[model samples]
Target: MTLRADAAGRERDRERTLAWLRGVSGELASATIKRLEETLPWYGEMPPGRRSAVGMVAQAGISSFISWFEDPRATPWVAADVFGAAPRELLRSVSLQQTLQLIRVVVEVVEDRAKDGDDVLQEAILMYSREVAFASADVYARAAEARGLWDARLEALVVDSILSGEYDDELPSRIAALGWHGHGEVAVLVGTAPRQLEVDTLRRTARHMDADVLIGVQGSRLVVVIGRATPRDDTPDGEEPVSFMTIATALEPSFGEGHLVLGNEVPGVVDASTSAKAALAGFAVARAWRGAPRPALADDLLPERAFAGDPLARTALVQRIYTPLKDSSTELLQTLWCYLDTGRSLEATARELFVHPNTVRYRLRRVADIIGWDATHARDALIVQSALIIGAMSESAATRRRPTRR
Candidate 1:
C-alpha cells in the first residue's frame, strides 16, 4: 500500500511538470526559431512558408520531449514525431547539414530551459537529442539513395537515345542534367559486354583518368562514347585532341575478351552519333578480320565494313583518302598506284613511271604529304589499294552517267 501511494504521488508530480512544459512550449518554440534565424544562414534564407514548417517541428520537439519524459520508452516515437510535423518539401529544400543545425539549435534551447529540472529529466533530453540526430541522418540517406536511382534511369535513357540516333532538342538539356563533363571530341567504342560488368568500376576508372563516358549495354554488346572531362594539354589552340586509341587502350579492361572497335573521333558529344554509327558498323564486321587488333580502329576496318555492305565505310574510303589524292595532283595519285601495284618497291615503281628511283622516292614522299597515309607501310598499302579500287570504280560510274561529250 505504501508503494502504491508513492506511485500515485509520482504520477501527480509528472502531470504537474507536463502542464508546466505545455504552458512554456510556445515560448520555447519561439525562442528556438529566433535562435535559428539568428544563427543559421540557410534557415534565415528560407521562404516564410518553410520557416513556419520549421517552427512546427520545433514545437513538435518540445511536445514530444514532454511525452518522452512521462514515458521513457517512447524515445523512438518522439524522434520521428518531430520531423512528422515538417512539410514534405522540407527535406528537399533543406540539406542534411542545415537540418542538423536546426536540431542543434532546438536542443540548445531545450537544454538551457530544462537544466534546472531533475537530473533524470536532463539525461532524458540529452538522449532524445541523440536519437533525433540519427533520425535526421536516416531521412537524408534515404533521399540520396532515391536520387541515385533516378539518375541511373535517366542516364540509361540518354545512352539509349545516343545509340539509336533518335534525339530531340531536349537531348542537350538532358545530357547537362546528367552532369556530363565532356565538351570536346567524342569517340564511340564497341565490344562484347563482360560476363560480370561493374558499372561503378567503369565510371571510377574514367573519372580517375579525367575522362567521361556514356555507357550502354545492348544484349551482348557494350557501347561507350568517351570524351575528355576537361580541356587537354595536347589539344592546345584547338589542335586535334589526344588520339582516341590512347583512351581506348586505357578503357580496354572494361570490356570482355572479344574484339573491341573504336570509331573515328567526332567534334563533340552531339556529333557522337556519327562516331557511334561507324563503331557499330565496324563492330559488326570485326570478326571477319582474322588478325584484328584488340581495339581495332573503325577506319582500319573500312574494307570489312564495305564488304558487309556498309555504304558509309565505302564513302569514307573514297572521300577521305581517294578524292584528296586524285584532286591534289595526278602525279601523287599515279605514284601511289604504281607503288602499291609494284609491292612498294622503289625500283619497280620508278621503272613503271620511267623515272629515276630517287624521283620515285620523292613522289612517294609527296604522296604521303598530300594524303597522310604512307604507301611504304604494309597496312597503309592495303588502305591505299582499297581507296584506289573504289576511286577508279567511282570515276568509271560517273563517266558512264555523264552525257557523251560530242
Candidate 2:
C-alpha cells in the first residue's frame, strides 16, 4: 500500500511540473530569442525574414519539449517537429555550428526558467537538447552527401561536353558553377585508366603543383584536362608557371601502364576540344611506336597518327613542317628531299645536288631551324619524310581540282 501511494504522489508531481512548463513556454521562447540576439552575432546579422524563421523554430522547439515531456516515446519526432518549422533555405544560410549555438541558447533559457521545478524537468531539458544537437548534425550530413553527388554528376557532364566538342551557351556557366580555377592555357592528357582510380589523390597532387584538372574516365581511357590555376601575368617574380609537360610527368604514376599522350597546349578551356582531339588520336596510335616514351607528346606521334587516318595529325605535319619549309625556300625543300632519298648520306646528297658536302650540312641545319625537326636524328627523319609525302600529295590534289584552261 505504501509503494502505491509513493507512485501516485510522484505522478501528481509530474503533472504539476508539466502544467508549469506549458504556462511558461511562451516566456521561455521570448527569452531564448532575446538571448540569441544578444549572444549570437550571426543571429543579429541574419535578415529580418530569416530571424523570424529562427524565432518560429525556437517556439516550435519549446512546444515539442512539452509534447516530449508528456510522452518520452515522442523523442523520434522531436527533431522533425522543431526543425521542420524553419524554411529549407535556413539550412543553407545557417551553418551546423550556428544551429548548435541556437540550441544551446534555447536550452539555457529553459534551464534557467525551470531551476525551481522538479529534477524530472531539468533531466528532460538535458535529454532534449542532446537529441536536437544530433538531429542538426544529421540534417547537415545528408545535405553534404547530396551536394557531393550532384557535383560528381555535373563534373562528368562537363568532361563529356569537352571530349565531344559540343558546346552550348550554358557550357561556360556550367564550368563556372563547378568552381573551376583554371585560367589561360589548357592541355589534355590521355592514357589508360588504372584498376582503382584515386581521384582525390589526383586532385591533391594537382593542387600541390598549383595546377587544376578536369578528370574523366571513358571505358579504358583516362582523360585529364589540365590548366594553370595562376595566370602568367599573376605569377610571382622569378617563379615561372609550371609547364603542362611537367604536370603530366608528375601525374604519370597515377595512370595505368600504357602510353600516355599529352596534347599540344591551347589558349584556353574553350579551345580544349582541339587539344582533346589530338590527344585522343595520338593515344589511339601510341602502340604503333615500338619505343614510345611513357608520356609521349601528341606532336611526337604525328607520323603514327597520320598513318592511322587521323586528319588532324596529317594537317599538323603539313602546317608545322611542310608549309614553313616550302615558304622559306625551294632549295631547302629540294635538299631535304635528296638527303632523305639518299638514306641521309651527306656525300650522296651533295653529289645529287652538284654541291659540296658542306653545302648539304648547311642546308640540313637550315631545315632543322625552319621546321624544328632535325633530320639528322633517325626519328625526326621519318617525321620529316612523312610530312613531305603528305604535303606533295595535298599540293597535287589542289592542282587537280583547279579549272583546266584552253
Candidate 3:
C-alpha cells in the first residue's frame, strides 16, 4: 500500500511540474524577457550562490530546449540539472538510454498535444524569469531593511550633531529618510518602571497624548522619546505657571510600582536634547525617592519647588491657597476656611466671623455647591484643601504674582 501511494504522489508531482513548464513556455516570447529585464539590475547585484542558481537554470533550460529540438532520444539524464535535483537520481530506477527513449516519447506526446493547440516549449525560456520574480521580492524586502538601518544611522548622527551644537540643520528630513516623522512638538519623556505595569501604562498614556514615540532598551532601563510634549500647566488658580509636584501627584498612582519624571517642556528640536538631559536628572531624583518614598515623583526634582513641603509650604500658604477667595465672593470660601481652622466647629466659625452658626452652615453648603463636591467628607475635603493651597501658591509663583500674605 505504501509503495502504491508513493508512486501516485510521484506521478502527481511530475504532472504539476509539466503544467508549470507549459505555463512558462507560454510566457517566453515577449512576456518572459520583459519581466526578467526589469530584474537584471538586482540579479547582477545578488550574491554568487544566487547568481549561480540563475546560471544553472539558464543552462538546464538550454540543454532541455536543444534536446527537444534535435533528437529527444540523444538527450542525457543531465538535462534535469537546470531545475535542480540530480538527473541520475531522478532517473535512478531506469537506464540512461531508457530515460532518453522515455523523453523522446514524452516530447513527441507534448508536441502532438501542442500541434493542434498552443506551443508550450516556449515555457523553458521563461524559467529563470519566474525564479527572478521570487528573488526580486526578497530584494525588495531587504531594501526595506536597508531603509530602516539608514534611518537608525541618521538618528544617531542627529544626536551627535545636536550634542555638538549645530542647531539649525534639517534633522527632520534625516529622520524622515528612515521613514518616520517627528511631528508636533518634540520633547523627551522618561519613565522608570520597577514594575511591569509602569512601562506599559506609560507607553499607552504617551500614545493617548498623541505623541511620536520611540522606545529603546538599555541594559535594565527603558528609554523613551516623546514628541510634542506641551508643558503641563498644573497650577489650577488660572496661573500660567507649571508645578512639577502636581504632575507627579497626578501620574503617581498610575505609575504602578514605577516612577514618572516630567522633563522640561521642550517644544522644538533645538531644546529637545537639553530637555532629555534634564529629564535624565529627574530620573536620578526618582532613584533617590526609593529610600524616602514621600508620595514621591520626579517633578520633585525641579530647581525651585524641589523643596516644597516644609518651610516653603508654611511660608507660601497665605499667598498660594487663600488668594483665590480675594477677588471673588469671599463669604462661602471664608466660612469654609474658618470652619477648617476652627476644627469643624460651626459655633467656633460663627464666633470668629461674628455671624450665626446657621450662617456658617449655609456658607459651607454653598461652597460645596459651587465647587461641585461636598468637601465636608474627610478624604474629599482634604483633597480640595490641598488642591486649593497648592493651586494658589504654585500658580502665584508661575505668574510672578506678589503673595497676598507674607
Each prediction's RMSD to truth: 3.2, 2.1, 15.0
Clashing pairs in model 3?
Answer: 24-123, 25-122, 25-123, 185-228, 320-392, 320-393
Of candidate 3, the 10-residue stretch with the lowest lDDT total is 85-94
Query: Where is model 1 poorest over a 10-residue stretch in terms of lDDT?
Result: 230-239
Question: For residues 109-178, what per-residue lDDT tens digits would candidate 3 score against the true structure?
Answer: 3444445433333453244334333433443455557756775566656655543446466766665564
TM-score of each: 0.87, 0.93, 0.39
- Reference-based lDDT, residue 320, model 2: 90
Q: What is the C-alpha lDDT of each candidate?
A: 0.84, 0.91, 0.49
Q: Which parts of model 2 have CA positions greater than 4 angstroms off? A: 1-3, 236-238
Clashing pairs in 2: none
Q: What does candidate 3 score on TM? A: 0.39
Residues 261-346 of candidate 2 have per-residue lDDT tens digits of 99999988888999999999999999999999889899999999999999999999999999999999999999999999999999
lDDT of 1 by residue, 1-406 (tens): 9999989987787787777777888889889988988998887787899989888988888788877777778566554788887878988888888888888998899888877876556777788888888888988898899988888788778878887889998988988987898887788999999999888888887777668888888899998989887555546685665567887888899899899999988778888888899999999999888889989999998888877888888898899889998889988888888888888899998888899999988888887887778888877777778888988998999999999878
Candidate 2 displacement at residue 108 in angstroms? 2.1
Error of 1 at 119 (Å): 4.1
Residue 59, model 3, lDDT:
40
Highest TM-score against the true fold, candidate? 2
